[model samples]
Target: MAQVLEFKLPDLGEGLTEAEIVRWLVQVGDVVAIDQPVVEVETAKAMVEVPCPYGGVVTARFGEEGAELPVGAPLLTVAVGASAADTPGPGEVPARDGRQDPPASVNGNSRPAAADAPGGAAEGSGNVLVGYGTGTAPARRRRVRPAAPATPASSAPPARPSPVPPAPAPTVAAVPGQDASRGEGPVPVISPLVRRLARENGLDLRELHGSGPDGLILRADVEYALRAAAAQGRTAQAQAVVAAAPAVAEPQPAVPASAVAPGGTRVPLKGVRGAVADKLSRSRREIPDATCWVDADATELMRARAAMNASGGPKISLLALLARICTAALARFPELNSTVDTAAREVVRLDHVHLGFAAQTERGLVVPVVRDAHTRDAEGLTAEMARLTEAARTGTLTPAQLTGGTFTLNNYGVFGVDGSTPIINHPEAAMLGVGRIVPKPWVHEGELAVRQVVQLSLTFDHRVCDGGTAGGFLRYVADCVEQPAVLLRSL
Candidate 1:
């Protein structure tokens, strides 16, 4: 007799609460081997592909594409013993502690699980649906970083006067007007972006003067310092980076004359795109919305990215950078980090930055949650982003990766668009839209020349986030991108 098992969505890590089905790699009735990727899922950090916990003939597809499922929700059923050599042992206990289990006895060293059994390990051990399990289940323990919002990088904007410069040499301050200290002291007001830039490039803000409004150091000043310092580090490296995504599909204009109505093929919208349409329409009508934007040039950031990759760092996408930047900006604008409390008739401000990265999958548009992005550094963020994006593309994303985001980032620059105004994910007060970076003529050292330019769009709730705060937040982000070093100070 064939034994049956139920597979449920497990925590994908970083406290993910839900995930949306991007697509199913295997169809019903397809025989699947243990650890064979069965589905692709979209989480906040990235797209992920999930392997089957139990090998068997897929008997049922319990969830639909574009559907958001909770942790432990039944996903599908598999018949473990349908074929010879696939039979389960009598009285086989479901993996009680799959996390602590060893590999199976099979020569392939697979982890074995009776696919049709109940309460199968949601995350799965090495042994699964195949007659035998292979490899150990991936480690389940996650590294926990200290809980604190990241500080914004202060370098994306044009340079301003230093409003908070330190005393030159300490000795000059005690004896005024004796040497270089004789001139008006350099302003020291540094934005989050500037502080980070200073640290990364070993720049002393006191050495360079800011010319921005109110003495705030803009990204230009940092770039200048970086140029003066690097010579080589800035130009030899450049790579593609992430930015915000724009609005929905445009209205169809006149149909092309070449194709007469033999009849337009009716493609049913399901999955990620379909889900995005449903939820975004609902949000537009039900939730009050507003937006603000600031252009950002990530030229320096692109350089930094190249340097990091060359140094054997994780391969990170531009989406990861926007997520990290927004995580930092949220700390200075916490009101945007909130949810609408239907039961309380008030907004609940979230202490942690549960960030959502909007991803497109065959199923539809889904926003996956990254529990606390502020806690992760660039390397960690890069790794998680890869994992999530892979899961999304492969149809194995877990349900928990889809829920509870305090803010969302929609990046479209991957396709090479310049900019767009993205909608806010409901309940959260704001969303960030990033666009492609292109070369533009900009003034450097008081001379006009080509530099990288990009645009940013910020949509926020009118009730909670005001224009000034939202605008300031965008400015903060812009400053960081233009001057990648600002991240050092914020950390």
Candidate 2:
């Protein structure tokens, strides 16, 4: 006989409490090796493949694809030490909740088995997740089935009727116009995606009936309801338009912006998008920010970069040169290299610089930070920036790489925009926005000439410094852009 071991969802790092099931690699009755990735999950931070620690036959899988499960929820069960006789067939799993169901041949497929096992605790890999640890497994409680109802000993048992009518299945339909989401009864939704979908479409989960077993709501049910509601809306709009028109020939009904297209795609903002939204909102709410900008002749900076590459072993990038200037500027204006501690009511000036730069990828905008950026030279900054940009593009950036910065350098110039009032990354004191360096007419040695001109904008938290300090920092950056040799003085 095989001893079934239950595995719960492991906690991913960075205080993540839940993950959406993206895909499952194994099925019931399939044998798996220890530490093999059994499922892929998407958290708020990243997509990760979760490995199972036990090498055994898969006896059950708890959640379906697209379901979001919290940490410590049962993921699957593995049957260890199984022989040919004990090997379950495809699509067959043990009964759940310690219920003593019949054999697989008699019971339906994917049924959960009793929760108890006779064998001792199973061993697992020492691989660490945030909250999960390798130690003695928790004891499983065996469920005792209630004894069959006792028959009268003094008299013969009642005879069965000619035919027994089956019990009516439970009805999930609520009274007309009754909202289930606000009711006292629990909703039968197990997936966060389903809840999000319903919420976004303004569909009340409690008012709708689920099509799955035991009144469980599935994604398909919500989609179907949305389609039906859309059709009804369109029809009502057409009727209203027809009633208002005077002529027999009907005019095309004006489309409302809120109406969903026939096959429009709706992407959920739960992962990177959600995190970005929350951060940007917090920055706007908490930071009293101000922006100061200046246009500078970048002819010298451009030439200096060309000269460095001309004589160089490792090629230098304009962004790296600008970053070098940023570090130099922050050194002079240490107030901009600090964060405000609201609880303590103090402006905390950091000694070291962890510079975050904005990078646009296919997923979204992400900031990858360079540790101790003030210590590294231009070449080192170039290499680290290249590595981080590639990692961000490939969606492989760790949370640590994405966070922890005292200042941010945003080169929105690559996007072809002249300038923007860049939002300061919250908790950080300031951000420097660089626009495109293009040819513009400027006075050179008392004569008009076309020079490489760039716009530099500084967005800083007003709470930390006044306008004079902010203007000084912007002027220093502008000076460095006009005369690259000015940066060497700080170097």
Candidate 3:
């Protein structure tokens, strides 16, 4: 009989519960060797492809494309030991329904599902690996459209494994008129219904400002703007027409705004707004945060970064440098390198720093972690940070990458905000916000002179670190940024 094997979901590392299936590398009825990849899974951090350990005929699929499967769930079943009963060409999807019968005694080509456990895939089927999934039901299709990418720095340390999280389904924006499947002209900023309403009402939305995230013109905003414009147009036309109709030259009375009320109903905080609120609340409620900012001269650091990038042996970034410095400081003051041990009676310090860079993905804010950042110096950190950020932007980041950050860094200077005290990433103690560096008046050497200044905010948890440590750490960061050479020296 064909030896059956069940492939379970992998742990996905960093305590991930579920992952989105980005792509399927293999299909059914194809004879495969051991350790061949089956699918590419998108975790919070980076995209990882899970390899199949057994060589057998594919029989069933537990989840579909774009489906999120929980950890330890049964992913697929394989019948091993038999030669290819049938070999389907590439790109052919196999039957997800379990209906295949077991063949007569065949070699045990299937890999064990899990060590010291039951027979694979309910016995006598395809070759598959075990321990790849959770036994629970398949995860929902909810999605996370990661927000714009920026550096996310933390002020505290790391804790151990957190609880099993619900799979955050990757979300596509509520686009107008355009279906996202074809990858056509920017996912419509507005929803389909909103687009229809705007069209029926002869709306010119180009002039109105977009209040939605990513500059998307919301339905309500568009409707309101349209009605106002139409109302004004009608009133002006009436005034002119009325004035011309009467040779008496009587002044036209002003029409009230209510006349333009093409009013429609709205659902608040149920879509993207709700997601934003949840993320904001989570950031505030769970993270013990305190923000403090300082202005530092960035003329030298900017010059240094330019020179390095121009030289191009390996390109680096200002954010990368900041991440490296933060890691170094966290190393010195290990107290800041910790996670809140919610179960335990205290905060648990991390042995290594997994730095989080706040990525502004189009969907929402995704903080992808740079594991063991302390081990990587300037160049490595820069490359890794750049790679992760790019991956995050492209929606290629996996779950592991999105989780496990001891601290977070957010650089709002790119948006030209001079200064802002950022909210903390939950479970982590602190975050560092890098503001705009502009030439401003300052007393250098007791003389009033203009110097390139940058605002750095290091928000931390007061429970684990006292003002002394926090201040010192922030000063160390400021010193590093003030003098680029200092970072090289510290390294």
**Residues 12-38 of candidate 1: C-alpha lDDT, one tens digit per residue:** 785555566767787656689998888
- lDDT per residue (tens digit) for residues 1-491 in model 2: 56778787887877877777777898766788899889877667656678998888776565566656667666676777774346555433323354333212101111122222222111111111111111212223332222222223322121212235622212223243444332443345535557779889887776555545434456656765565556555656666777898454433333333343555777866667777888889999999999999999999988999999999599998999999999999999999999999999999999999999999998789899999999999999999999999988876777778778899999999999999997789889899999999999999999999999999999999999999999999999999999988887888
Cα-based lDDT for every prediction = 0.59, 0.70, 0.61
Residue 411 CA displacement from its true place in model 2, Å: 1.1
Instruction: Name the Cα RMSD for model 1.
Output: 31.4
Return the TM-score for candidate 1, rounded to 2 decimals: 0.50
Candidate 1 runs further than 4 Å off: 1-266, 362-364
Candidate 3: tens digits of C-alpha lDDT, residues 147-200: 422222221111112245522211222333333332322222333345557568
TM-score of each: 0.50, 0.67, 0.54
- Separate clash counts for every candidate: 100, 7, 75
Which one wins on lDDT?
2
